[model samples]
Target: MQLVEDDKYGWSAKPSSCEKGHAPKEISVDFDEVYKSIILPAINLINGTNLGIKIDCTRGEDLLDGGNIVSQFLQKICQAEITITDVTGFNSNVIFEYGIRLSVRDSLNILLCHEGVKLPLDFAEQRFKTYHMGLGGGNDAKDYIVETIRHALPLLLAEKSVESVENLFRRTVENATGRTQERRLMEVFEPAPDLLVRLLNALNTICSEANAPGDKKVFRLDPKLRDETWKLLEEIGKTMENSSNLSRAIELYELLTKLEGFREKRRDVFYNLNKLCSANPDFKEKAQFFLERGIELED
Candidate 1:
C-alpha cells in the first residue's frame, strides 16, 4: 500500500513550527501549495490497487476545505470501485498518514498486476474471507493473513492450473476448514462472554434444524462430533445461568468448539470454568475441581 499526502494550503511548507507564535498567513500559503501539487497525483493512481483509497481532509484547516475538490478528482480516477474513507482532525498533515497506507497498497498492487497472473475470482473471494472473518483483531491475524496469501496464492494458482473447479474447491476446503477450526479454538479459550450464549444458541438451532442435514453437513456430526459436542455442552452446563436454556447453548457451544479444534485453548478451559463457577452458585464444586486440575497442570 502506498500513500501520498498533498497539503494544498501549504500549511506544512512554512517555518511556523520554529516561531512560538501561530501565523495564520504561513498556514494559508502551505495549504495552497499542497492543493496544487498533492491532490491530483493521488487521484490518478487509484485504479491499480484493490484496497482502494482513503482520503483525509483535516489538513486544509481554515482556508479552503479540500474535500470536495479531492473527492471530485478521485471520482474522475475510478468512478465506482474506488473507496473513499475520509477523516477530519486538527492535525497539520493528515495526508501523510494516508499516503503511507497508499504506498504499501500500491506495492502489493504492483506485484499482483506485474505477475500478469489473474487469480480466479474464487481464489480472491477465499483470500478475502480468510482476511475479514478469520484473521486476528490486533496485529497477529492481519500479518498472518497477508503473509499467508503472499505465500499461498502462487502455489494455489499453479497447482490448480488446467484443473476443474471441483479440484480447486477440494484443495481450498481443507484450508478453509483449518481456518474455521483455528477460530473455533480461539472462541473456546476466549469466549465472547457477552455474545457466547446467544451465538451458541444460534449454532444449536442450526445444527438440529431439519435443514441441518445434507447440505448443512458442514459440521459433520459423527462419533468425533458427538464427543466434542458433549464436551462443549458440559463446559456450557458448568457456567450456564438457571434461566438459560441448558440444551441449546450447551449443545451449540460444544459442537462449535469441538468442530473448530481449540488445541491451544485447552488450558483455558479451567480458567473460564472458574469464572463461570463464580458467576453461578450451583457450579462452585465443579468449578473448584477444574480449577484445581488447571493449577496442577500449571505446576
Candidate 2:
C-alpha cells in the first residue's frame, strides 16, 4: 500500500492488491509525509504482531467510490472502530470530522498533532498525542503513536467506555445543577436540626448497607448518591466547625471516618477532629486517638 497525495484531499492510501478484504482503520491527516513516515510505520508495527486484530489504514478519501464524499466520510467516521485524526495544521475538515466522532463515540478516538501546536479551546482539555516532525523525529513520532494505541487497546477490548468530550461537558453541567439543588435542600432543612441529622444518618446507613455483605438485590446505593452524601457531610462538618459548634462538627467528622467514600480526606478529618477534641479536657483520650491516626496516615 502507498500513500498518494490528492489535490482535493491532502493524502490518502492507494489500496494495493494485498490490502483488500480486511477491516479499514481510518486515519485523518493533513500532510502526505505524515502518512508515509509516521502513521504508516506505526501501523506496520501494530499489524505485524499477533495482537488479535489487523489494521488496514485508510483515509476518508480512500473510501470514495463514485458517491457523495461528505456522506461516505461521515459514515466512515461514525462506524470505524478507531478514528485517528492528525490535527497538526488544525485543518477545518479534519476538525469537523473529529467533532462528529467525539459526539457519537465514547472511546477509541485519538488526536495526533505536531509538537507545540495549540488546539482550539473546545478541544484543549481532550487528551491528544503530540510529536515533532523535524529531522530524526519520525521514529519518535511513530513510537509515540504505537504507545498511544497500545494503551487504548485494553479499554477497547474490556468494553469499558471512556468519557467522551461531549459527555464530559454534559456531566459538568449536571453536577453544577445538582450541587445547587442540594444547597437549596440543605437550606430548607437547616432550621430543623433534628430532621437534618436524621437525613444525614439515613444517607450514612444507605452507604453502609450498600457495601455490607448480603444479597445484592436487598441493598444497593447509586455511586452518585454515595459521593453526594459524602460531599454533603464534609461541607456540613466544616460549616459546623467554622461556627464553633465543635460537638456537632466532631460527630460529623467521626461519621466520615466510618464511611468508605473519600478515603483521601480522612487524614484531614482526623486533623480537624484532633484539633476539636484537644480543646476540651474531657476529650483528651479521643484527641490522642485522632492524633495517632493522623500521624499513621502520613506514612
Candidate 3:
C-alpha cells in the first residue's frame, strides 16, 4: 500500500531542512534494480537455508514520513535488529542516516559501498564491503554479503534464545574458538521424538501381539530402563520379532536406516530390514533397494 502524509510517522509539511538540498537529496528510486541486485537475492538465499529461517527488509524511503514521524522513524531505526547501510555514491543522507543507526546500535550492522566510491574518513577504522557492478566482475560483492549473512544468521538466531549474560558469553567464546562450533552442536543435539514415532511404537506392540494364533496372549516381562539405550532398542526389537509383524518391523527398521545421524547401527538396521522383507512381498524390493543403498554408502 502507498504511504499517505497523514499517518502517525509521516510529515505533511515541506521537506525538513535535513532532507532538502544536498541532504534529502533526490534518491534514485531504482527499486527494481535494487531488488534485482541485492534484496531479493539475499532473501532467497536466507529462505533456502532450511533452518526455518525467515528474513525481510525494506528501504527506509519506501515508508511514510512526517508528523512526529522523525522520532518514530529514528525509533524504528533504533529498534531494527540488523541494519545494512550502503555508502554508494557518497550520498550525504545515507551517511547521516547510518550515523543515526550507529548512535542506537554499534554491532549487528554491516556497511557496504560500490567500488571506487569515496569512503568517509571518520569511519576509517571500520571495515566495509566493496561491491562491483557491470561486466568485468564475475562475482558481485553483494554475494559476499549474502553469503556472510547466511552463515551468520543461524548463529545469531541461536543466540536469541540465550537468557543470561554468562551463558551468552560462554556461547560467544565457543563461537570465537571456531565458526563451526555452533553448527556442530546443532547437528548433534538430539531432537525429541515426534508424535508419529511414539504412535508407531505403540502400534508395533499391538500388531506384534495380535499375530499369535494358538496360545493365550501373554505380554512378556521386559526389563526396566537401562542406562544404555541401544541395548534397549535391541531388546525391544527381539521382543517384537516373536510376533512376526513384518510391516511394523520394516517401518521401525526403515526409520533407523534412513537417519543420517545413525553411525555403526545403520548396518544392523539394513540387516533387520532385509530379514523382515521375506515375510512381506510388498516390502521385498524396497528392502533390497535400501540394502543396496546402505552397501553403496559403506563402500
lDDT score at residue 186, model 2, on the 0-100 scale: 41
TM-score of each: 0.20, 0.42, 0.40
lDDT, each prediction: 0.34, 0.56, 0.45
Across residues 138-247, which tens digit of lDDT does each residue of candidate 3 receive?
Answer: 14655765676666654454432111222222233244456342223222221212222233233345445656566756442122211123343444445444333444
Residue-wise lDDT of candidate 2 within 1-299, one digit each (tens)? 21111101112222222232111233323366667788888878987877776666777546524323444455445445566677665666567667666676745666766666666787778777666556766687678767877777665555522223222222332343364332333443344433443444455466556666777544333456555555555555445433334455565556556655546567877887787677677678989999999999996
Residue 116 displacement (Å), model 1: 56
Per-residue error (Å), model 1, residue 269: 2.7
* lDDT computed for candidate 2: 0.56
lDDT of 1 by residue, 1-299 (tens): 11222111111111222222122332212323222233323333332346332322222232232223332222122211112221211224333433332432221111111012233463333222111111231133224324533443333323311112222222232353364332333334333321332344344444455354365444433444445544555665566566234324433443444443443344465565556655666657856875786686683
lDDT of 3 at 217: 65
Per-prediction CA RMSD (Å): 21.2, 18.2, 21.7
User: For candidate 1, what is the TM-score?
Assistant: 0.20
For model 2 the TM-score comes to 0.42
Candidate 3 clash pair list = 10-65, 10-66, 11-65, 11-66, 11-67, 19-24
After superposition, which runs of candidate 3 have C-alpha atoms over 4 Å from their true positions?
1-32, 64-67, 136-138, 158-299
